[model samples]
Target: MRPGLTIGEFATVTHLSVRTLRRYHESGLLEPAWTDDFTGYRYYTAEQIPTAQVIHRLRQLDVPLAEVETVLSADDPRRREEVISGHLRRLEAELDRTRAAVVSLQRLLHPDPADLAVELRSVPTRTVAAVKGVVKQDDSLSWYDAAMAELDAAFPADERTGAPGGRYDNELFTHGAGMFTVFRPVRRPRATGRVEVLDLPGVDLAVTVHAGRHDDIDVTYGRLGTWVVTHALAVDGPIHETYLVGPRDTPDAAEWRTEIGWPVFRLATGTPERAAADRRR
Candidate 1:
């Protein structure tokens, strides 16, 4: 038997097509061990089979050609592993996002629309330890985790007065990027890292609780918005979200509760006194 396998034989041995081997050779990804000078025929040695299999596996994972090249050419084994690990991390994150989307779609398709219960709460001015970020909507979730982690490290559980909350600016929804503030209601709030003491102004809020995870929280927001429009005018302010029970409280998402608040003034016959009198009834 000949020492050099023809391209077709190599393709058969590696479960790769002849056309793919030629393309790989053309891209300088997998050059043949030997080439005929006159006929321009390509041949591979048995030693290249393991490399061919590795490249095929990487490609099967949908790894980018550039990254696959990096893994192949990297001198250090650790560097090759780093490229593979990074891609795996990205795949995991994408899987989580896909799972969340599937759950949301299922809920929407077979919805059990229940009447939303809203409460009018008169909030008082309070000082809290907070972390703020100016970020795009796409990055809000990651930024929230980082900022909330910072807040968590600074304040012990015993020091917290109430559930953690966040304020979101309108520009985040309308203009793609805006300011976000995450705060923990703490006794003797102080500045640490990104965390700062913020004096939150008092306002009346029409609040409703959203059950379960945030994947379908938008539906609750829609219902609350409709309730606000019918009952009272929406006052211009950042929207508030209170995580009454979350991952920190319980691993079970079914037990999670989030309070959404829209700042508002009571509707009445056009005067502060009239609104005050109506509230007294």
Candidate 2:
């Protein structure tokens, strides 16, 4: 009945606006099958309907125009699938952050002092096999992985005395960079490559277990910090994080448990009875 589908007709069929199709053509994302030399009107083919629909779905997922073009122009199906899969992974990480934010907001709106159970402990001096570095906050995660891997290789199951832990200095959070030490408690700590035998000093700590993924670990830190300050306990040393049950031990994030130890000293101004009441509450 007609020579070809006009721009308006193609847009209506694809559920895309006339302006959007025009933009796509201008950007070389989705060019029309034909153009009239006389009137300069654009025309598309019935076969292009699928391509338009695919582009629509990709755009809906917030894929960048360049990435969408890469996906569309990919010759191999596997290559196209890889591009989509990468985008999906990014979306999943964003969803995790959003969920963590929602949980933090709910806790903030409805404060529960008892949500985090704090325990005070006096730890003795100990020796450990550790890798030390001065790293920025952004690089800390990757550095941690490499350091932990080295420690694990050094001490097999038979030699390990305790779970792997990391000691982070206050300047790490205050100045965006600081000394970080990741260590493994072992029966016989030794020096190997960057891993060295270090003597860790004794200290009093107010500790708490942060459950689940670390996406919202900052909320737990906040809660712990609040408790330490209100109970007349002053932070005294670098923060310690012991990976009791971590990703290396289990694939389930829900089962992961991290012990956050805040080094502190008790001020004599506080009443023991009041502190006991606070703990019981």
Candidate 3:
């Protein structure tokens, strides 16, 4: 009943539920300036109103409870601003990533069919420097990151030195399997570490160029699969992906092109047993 307000009064002023204010009090993020021992009631002074407003603002910013506590406890306004600004920067970066993913999804759902860019290519035997590893589709990101790191460490900066790429089997894509790969470009050979250099003999393959965010690359795969089937061809070997341009080289998604190849053979109006036996030699 003094000039100060009770917990309920403070809650009304703050526009926060009494329960939430009580939680903040229990969490030590906010505390009453005074308490009535016999009544077990909490009381707050006018000075405490600013603290309540700050808690509301920080919560609105999605700041973590621990971080909010740090900002609240800091005596210097500059220090508090620094902490909030740092958090805002991180949130902005996350927003950008989310926006990119959304755009990529939209492109996937509604792709330009008129630009049905496809080609029949005959790939020849060649050498490639690579790192090899077996990885599940879900963990492909980690696997690829490790491979690229190793390749980058092995090779110096140069023009002929292109982005890291891989070849994965249809089984891996269609029915999640341990993805295997050689990270760098090297000459064709019989064996090389877990990564073996083998010649991919010249075979006419239906090729398609998928351009955009890697997050939605699956759309290209699905479309290309239909292309192969419609043409009466069955996948013969592993799916090979050549990165003509990469994020490291450019931030523009439209400029990124992934050459997808489904090693195929002419289907004779029936289910064709996998022609090229899966092997690493």
Candidate 4:
């Protein structure tokens, strides 16, 4: 109608729907060059076409409308690139998670028949430097990484005595939040930052090693649980995970070995009754 293009013509040129363009205008993400006062009609100059195209590209990536505005408003090319790159990194991380989920789902649909090897052992008490805290289930891995790094920094290579291990409360898995304690044996225990010296009491446990990536570690846990239910009875104690060979030891995931320990009591006498009672408890 005017010297510039109408909303419909702009949408056709940009390959964006009229509804989407209207939304962008209302959200202040993109504005028409001019609007008629009496008719309330919108008009966009040819110069605004590039802006519409840029908005279209960003929206295709599912970038937030506000972020799109920020990107468009950025004067420096590097600053605009940095903003887009940050979103790309997040998308990449999401892609990785999606791939992992696909693999897990495939394994669930077609499970491996091989049985896990489990052993019962008695552990002795020991003094160690440890860090303890409450962590959400989703944040557990990142928190563990940070805590372990702190412990490693506290004790040098020579002072470190043995492999690192962690104790996890059942509530973490059941209720999505619980206490987590990670400890490593040291030649001489001392407090540093969040780390402190503490004595861990001896306990009997049913243990199984989960090899390779943690992607299918749940399968191993299920097998270990089945073995415990049939041969022994689980007692009240935190689950212990000893990093026999972990990420620090090897870059290859196949070489990783984590010993999963479930505190247990032998079911030699009154097996059925005690087992049922324990289950009830």
Candidate number achieving the greatest TM-score relative to the actual structure? 2
Task: State the lDDT at 239 in candidate 2.
Answer: 98
Residue-wise lDDT of candidate 1 within 171-262, one digit each (tens)? Answer: 98889999999999998899988899999988778899999988888777877898877654577788999999998789999999999998
- Which scores greater on TM-score, model 1 or model 3? 1
Which numbered prediction scores highest in lDDT against the true structure? 2
Q: What's the TM-score of every candidate structure?
A: 0.80, 0.85, 0.66, 0.75
- Compare candidates 1 and 4 on TM-score and give the better one: 1
Q: Relative to the true structure, how large is the alpha-carbon lDDT of every model?
A: 0.88, 0.89, 0.72, 0.87
RMSD of 3: 6.7
Candidate 2 lDDT tens digits, 129-176 = 999999999889999999998988888999998999999999999999
- The positional error of residue 118 in candidate 3, measured at the CA in angstroms, is 1.4
Candidate 3 lDDT for residue 127: 67
Candidate 1: how large is its RMSD? 4.3
Clashing pairs for predicted structure model 1, backbone only:
none
Clashing pairs in 4: none
Better of 3 and 4 by TM-score: 4
Residue lDDT tens for model 3, 136-175: 8877867777776666655556523455567776566667
> How well does candidate 4 match the true structure, expressed as C-alpha RMSD?
4.7
| Candidate 1 structure lDDT | 0.88
- The per-residue C-alpha lDDT of model 3 at residue 261 equals 76
- In model 4, which regions exceed 4 Å deviation? 1-53, 76-86, 89-93, 266-281
lDDT rank, highest first? 2, 1, 4, 3
